[model samples]
Target: MDIKLLVKLTSRAWALDILAHLHRGVPGRQATLLAATGAGRTAFGASLQHLMALGLVARNPGHGHPLRPEFILTAEGKAAAAKADAILRAAEVSAAGLLRKSWTVPVLALAARPQRFSGFKAGLGAITDRALSTSLQRLEAQDWVAREIDLSERVPFPVYRAVNAGGEISRVAEAAV
Candidate 1:
């Protein structure tokens, strides 16, 4: 649940979904996982490959036919899967999709309190302004984040804070940290 690992896990669209399903005891066959995650074959395959590259997932040798291999979580994968499950559980089913986005969880994790735009940019390191803006707008639309205008300064600014399900997700993300 290190920040870097969390960022890598979220880099792929379906990686966390795959991990959550695996942690929930779903069979790890490609088809089974594909069905469970509701992910397309190619994207799911890519995410699965990404997980393997991260050493969080590995093929179970001698466990299945060559054409249909079974995947097992490595020890590190189990820990990560647990965190993924916690995150998904914290989010509403509809909002789970936002969690799949690159910056959402990281942003939420940092937004446990109100923050300015620059605060988020500084904390997240490499996120582009457009990406951060899009993620914030989406979360705001979902009512997961609330944006308030700060008029105290000569130049007005917007501050973002996690609310509702977003607050829960932020708690989970902070706990992982």
Candidate 2:
């Protein structure tokens, strides 16, 4: 029931986005989803594979390619996506509540650009280095943000980018607007 537990760990935003899309109902076909999500074929295919592996989606016998097959969400997958949706929604609520005047306003500002820890730290304005670090770490751990470390140098700077997560963010933002 606790949403925090769900957001605590996930691979990436796309993973959650894929789940949210599946949760809408079992997809009839990959082409239908590709058109719905506007995601490229490669991205859609990979996500579909993962969903199937997780039992969130399964091959639905129908007109796919005549040789291969089509896919749809399983009952278990629908249940899982629903759970993920709730947890992500709760996390966003919690995060929004924590916001003050300029506290994290700028990080949200970067909603357009893919940002890293250092860039966000610089944008947060009044937050302490420690606080920003904590927030980013929490977000990363919860699968809200994808962390990438560039080890090209001896010292790596980690970057954080937000994930879609079951369309929770999209739904919440649209509702707010």
Candidate 3:
């Protein structure tokens, strides 16, 4: 989703992980934050600065013994997270494709049966012939899927099949279904 946490964080990957961890009830502790971020102590401090400056996180003071700092989302931070959630939900609604997050269902469907052009179109749901062809071609180029050119008559038909079988997209497709 559109968590501006993504926009605010220094590295998109770490930012996303941190926000997701928080959303899942992981409280922000220094050691855990470092682990979650995959950041060295020095880098972690820089990241924390960004998070704080963005108003998405703050130091939780009460829990510390010798003044150790526990990081937490401020109200504004939570609001941003919520907004991100809403943006993600809205995208799923509008695009009818959450494949970016979870391609499991679609990936499985494709894997279970790589299809000829017609069948592929039907399975993918309401894709235009041109877009469908383009996507198939692109997937073929990426080696994620293969297209065997079928030619017996006037037109060329291609049957698609999974190449990697279990990449990120495949996992997402599998999860979706």
lDDT of each: 0.92, 0.52, 0.52
- Model 1: lDDT of residue 11: 90
Over 80-165, each residue of candidate 2 has an lDDT whose tens digit, in order, gives 66754543454454453222212222333343246666676555445578867766565555555567787777987776666644
Q: Which candidate's TM-score is highest?
A: 1
The digit string of per-residue lDDT tens for model 3 on 4-31 reads 2232342332443454455556768878
Error of 3 at 105 (Å): 23
**TM-scores for candidates 1 onward, in order:** 0.95, 0.43, 0.41
Model 3 earns a TM-score of 0.41
Better of 1 and 3 by lDDT: 1
Better of 1 and 3 by TM-score: 1
Order of candidates by TM-score, top first? 1, 2, 3
Candidate 1 lDDT score at position 171:
89
Give stretches of model 2 more than 4 Å off.
1-9, 87-177
For model 1, residues 1-177, the per-residue Cα lDDT tens digits are 777788788999999999999999999899999999999999999999999999999999889999999999999999999999999999998768888888899899888989999999998888899999999999999999999999999999999999999999998987876
